[model samples]
Every structure is written in structure tokens, then in C-alpha cells.
Target: MDRVRLLVLLTVFVDILGLGVVIPVLPFYVERFSNSPQAVTTLIAVYAAASFLSAPLIGVLSDKYGRRPALIGSILSTSLGWFIFASGKSLLVLYVGRIIDGLAAGNLPVAQAAITDTVKDEKERGQVLGYVGAIFGIGFIIGPAIGGALGHLSVTLPFWFVGALAAVNAVLAYFFLPETRKQQEAHTHPISLNPFSPMKRAIQQKDMCSNYLAWGMFGLAVASTQSVYALFLNVAFGWEEFMVGLLFMATGIVLAVNQVFAMRNFWLKKFTEPKLELWMTAAFAFGYVLIGVASFPLFIVGAILTTFGQSVLRVVMNSQMIAKSNPTRRGEVMGISASIVSLTAAIAPLFAGWLFDLRPSLPFFAAAVFLGIGFFILYSAQKTLPTTLDPRQPVVSEI
Candidate 1:
């Protein structure tokens, strides 16, 4: 890989590492303040809610100022958030930490835009993104194991460690990460900070609205399933902290292998992007259904299917979105995409948590239903969507 690609991958690895370390242990940590699993999911939702509001603004900032500064500043904010979370003594303090982190959640979109800036070849772009996904899988594999072991010692230990890593990452980016956005074309039309602005612009484009809708529905399904997964395992299988970590590790392995070995090399060559997306959505729906009714052995099968399906779907969808965007506005387009996903992230956990309180299986059932609807939308819209970009024109025409 090239130097810029490697740095972007490292940045993503460090960011996702913090998430992997925290997610498995967050429920237990929050239980120190509140006994309800619903409260834990609410904490997760609060972070996404903040991100939902901030992501487009951050994207606009990166477009106006530059990607490197945006990345470094966001990383610094994450470190501060982790520090706050580690030191907090009250539930409100925990919310404060998540809010801080959420406001800086534009790091991922900026990093993705940087990659889009450097890579011009559409096929190679998809392959490189798979590498990014592979890094995410590797981070999850290592981070959760370490976090689980540390959690056995003290719940706060993993947070301190992750905070320290984020600080170091910020310093490294300051010294080594180069600016990729061209200076001459840096300024664009004035960007609105309103969270709904990106969505409104997206909706005005007839060709793109259905794609965004499908992507948002996919986000909702995945977020809802994730919100209740650990709790479900605890209730149904009586798994401990370490076992939960192991299960996530296994899912990560499946994800990494599919991205690196299958999607990057074979599948992208074999299938059209829209066709792959449609199949993956169906796979996710089936996997969720299986998980909803699963016993121990069947649960493993369902988990593998779900991980593989989502992993492929994410890479394909992201590749298509980037390809369909004007090169100059890649950052803005990605920010809008993140905003759509974050909006779902904000809402799904609250809904899932409420359903979980009613019945453990209800969240998974809801996820399957959502994915099925997303699949239908994508399938219906496949004929109008272009798989390749016309470099001279914007990918979608505004109405």
C-alpha cells in the first residue's frame, strides 16, 4: 500500500480500537451507576445523537479548513472524552463524555474523504476500503481481548489505556499525516451547520434519495441489533465478560477474512455493486431471523452470516457512494452519508432497548424486518442507479 493509505488505515485502527475496548465493557461500567440495560443503550444513543448533529458540520469544516487539522482535532477530542469517561463519578458525567466524543465523530468521514482524495481508480478504491475494513476487524480482535482482561482487574483500566492511545495517535497525526485536499479548490458554497441540511440536499436528488433511504434503513437494522447483543447473550447463555469479548472477536475474524480474502479479491470482480448489495441485504435479513430463533450452535451460524453479509454490504455501498460523488465534494458527500447513519444510530438504540425490555428476541425480529424493507428498496431502485461515474458531471442531478 501507499504511505497515505497506510496512515489512514492506522488512524482508523486506532479509532476503532477505542470503540472495541469500550463496547463489550460499557454495559457493566454503566451498571455501576444504573442497574438498567436500557440506561446503557440510552448512553450509546446519546453519543450517536450528538454525532448526528455534528457530523455534517465537521465535514463542512474539513472541506473549508483541511482534512489533517480536522482529523487531529477530532482525535484529541476523543482522547479527552475517554479521560472524562474514566474519571467520572456520576451518570451525568458519563453523558458529558459521550457528548464530547460524539461531537468529534467526524474523524471517520474525514479519513474516508482523505482516502477518496488520494485514490482515483474506482476498482482500486473498493479494494483499499476493504483494507480499511480489515484494519477495523483486526482492531476489534485485539482490543476486546485486552479490554476484557483488563476489565477483570478494573472497569476503568481499559478506558485509561484507550485514552492514552488516542492521545498518542493525535500527536502522531500532527507530525506525520499530510494534507490531501487541494488548496485551490478548498472553498465551496457556504456550508450549513444545520444537521438536516445534508439530508435535504440528498432528498432533492431523485437518483440518490432511494439509495440514501436504503443505506439509512440498513444502518437502523445494524444499530438496533448491536444495541442489545451483549445483553441477549447474558440473558440467554449466561456468558460472562470474557466470553462476550470472545464472541465479538470471533465475529471480527469473520468480518476481516471476508473483507480481505473474499470481497477485495474475488467478489468485486464477480458481481455488480447493486447486485452484491441486494444479495447482502437478503443475507443480513436471513441472518437476523436465524439469530432471533437461535440456540447455542445455531447462534454461531447466524453470527457468521450476519458479520459476513454486513461487512461486504458496507464496503460495496461505500465504494458506490464515493464513486457517484463529485471528486471535489467527496468530503461533503461522505459527511452526509455519515449523518444518515448517525441519525439511525441515534434512534435505533432507544427503540431496541425498549423492545428488549419487552422481549429479548424482539430487537432481532425488528432488525430482520428493517433489512427486508431495505432490500426491497434497493432492488426496486437498481435500474436507475449508475455503477460507474461520469467524471465531467455530478453523479446525481438535483431536481
Candidate 2:
């Protein structure tokens, strides 16, 4: 890998690592202010809501101003958000922190755009993205462990640690990260501050619409499962908190291994992106159904299957979206994708919580159904979508 690609990867890794360190401990911190589990869940939604509102705007800014400035601003915002969260004296303060973090959540898309700017080859892009996915998985796995351990000292300690990490990362990036987007004359247009405008424009294209719908469904499924998975385990198997964390760690390890080693070394060689997506959808559907059955051994199997499926699918879909988009518009397109997923994530958890109250297994079944719908959408659009993984060919929109 070249220096630019490696720097982009490092930026993504550090950003995700900060997120990982905070998430596991967040709910516990929130409970100190409010006893309601719903309140904690609401905090998650608030962050997603802010991200949904700010993502497209961030993308537009990156396009107009340059990725380097946008990235630096985002990192600074994240550091500030974590600092506020750590120092919070009230629930309102916590909410404010989350909103700040969400509004600055452009790091992933900006980093991805930076990678696109650097790597021109489609296959090489996919491989590098697989590594990014692996970094994300590893960060999540290690982050929770760090948070859990730190919580023994103080619930807010992890937040403080992550805040410092983000601040340090921002300094490093400001010094080392160069502008990847070439300086060019700005295109004249009325820049819409409305967050939904970019998303609307992206989805108006026929091919992009199908892809977005499929991606949205997939996000919904994952969000719903995440909302209730720990509770489901406790209800069904009487597992304790440590067991739950262990399970998550195991799944993350599997996912990271699959993306970094399996996909990079084997899967990309054997299957096109579309075919890989189909197979992953099938795996997701099967895994969700198995999880709903609520047997211990089957649950383990389901965890492994779902983790592998979802991990590979995420990298594959991201690669496809980047490839299908016009090179110049990659940031805008990715921002739209991020915004839609955030919207779904904000909504899915509330719906899943309600369904879980109705039936412990309902959320799992619903996740399967969502994935099934996603599968059909992809299947129907297969002919219209690009058959090969190469981005150099005319994309589906051009057809």
C-alpha cells in the first residue's frame, strides 16, 4: 500500500476506535442520570438523527472546500463531543454531546472519498476497502474490552480517554494528511443547506434508487438485531453481561478475519460483487432465522454466519456504490448512502424494542424478513446493475 492509502486507513481506524471505546460504556453512563433503558436507546437515536441531518452537508463541504479541511473539522468536533460527554452533569449534556458527535460523523465517508481519490483501480479499491472493514471490526472488538475494563475505575473514564485519543489523532492528521482532491474551480450552483437534497438527487437516478433501497433494508435489519440481541440472549439463555460481551467479541473477531484475510485473499478472486452480495443475503437470511429459534448451539452458529455475511456484504456494497458513481461525485454519493443508513438506524431500534416487548423473537424474524426483501430487490436489479466489478466500464446509470 502507498503512503496515502495507509494514512487514510489509519485515520479511519483511529476514528472508529474512539467510537468503539465509548459505545460499550455509554449506556451505563446514561443510566446514572436516568434509570430507563429507553433513555439510553434514545441517546443512540439522537446521535443517528444528527448524523442523518448533517452527512450530506458534510459531503458537499468536502467537495467544495477539500477533504483535508472537512476531515480535520470532523475530528475536532468528535474530540469536543467526547469531552462534553465525559464532563456531563445532566442528561441534557449527554444529549448535547451525542448531537455534536453525530453532526461531525463525516469521518468515514470523507476517509472513503480520500481512498477513492488515491486508488484508481476498481479491484485494488475493493481490496483496500476490505482492509478498512477489517480495521472497523477490530476496533469494535477491542474498544468494548477497553471500555469494559475502564468502567471499573469510572464510567466516564473511557469517554475521557477517547476524547484525548481523538484530539491527538486530529493533530496528527492536520500535520500529515495532504489534500487528495485536486484544486479546481468551484462549480457555480446554489448550495442547498437542506440535508435531504443530496440524498434526493442521488436516489433519483434509477440504478442508485435500487441500490439505496436494498442498502436501507439491510441497515434496518442490522439495527433491529443490534437493538435487542443482548436482551434476547439474556431472556433465552440467562446469559450475563460478561457473556454478552464475549459473544460480541467473538463475532467481531470472525468478521475481521473474514474481511481482512478471506475476502482479500480468496472471495474477491472467485466471485463478482453482485454474486457475492446474493450469497451474503442468503447467509444473512439463514442466520436470522436460526437466531430466532433460540437454541444455544444454533445461536452460536447463527452469530458466526450473520457476522461473516454482514461483514463481507458491507465492504462489497460500499465498493459497488463507489464504482457506480461518477468519480467527481463519489463524496456526494457516499454521503447520501451514509445518511439513509443513519435514518434507518435511528428508526429501527425503536421499532425493534416495541416488537421485542410483544415477542422476544419477533425482532429476529423481522430482521430475516428485511434481508429477504433486500435479496429480492438485488436479484431483480441484477441485470441492470454492473455484472463485473470493474469501475472503468460504463456504469449502470450510463446504460
Which candidate number would show the highest TM-score if scored against the true structure? 1
Residue-level lDDT of model 1, residues 87-113, one tens digit each, is: 989999999998999888888888988
- By lDDT, who's the top model here? 1
In candidate 2, what are the lDDT values of residues 1-399, reduced to their tens digit?
788888888888888887777665665677799865567667777888999988878877887778888898989899999899899999999989989989978888878877777765777878888888888888878876777777767888999999999999899999999888755522234668888788777756776777788899898898887766766787899864455656666776887888788987888888888888887998998999999999889988888889888988887888888778766566776787788888888988888877887888888999999999999998998976557655544264621
Q: Any idea how many clashes model 1 has?
A: 0
Candidate 1 overall lDDT versus native: 0.83
In Å, residue 194's CA in model 2 sits off its true spot by: 1.8
**Every candidate's lDDT:** 0.83, 0.80
Q: In lDDT terms, how accurate is model 2?
A: 0.80
Candidate 2 regions exceeding 4 Å error are 184-190, 239-241, 392-399
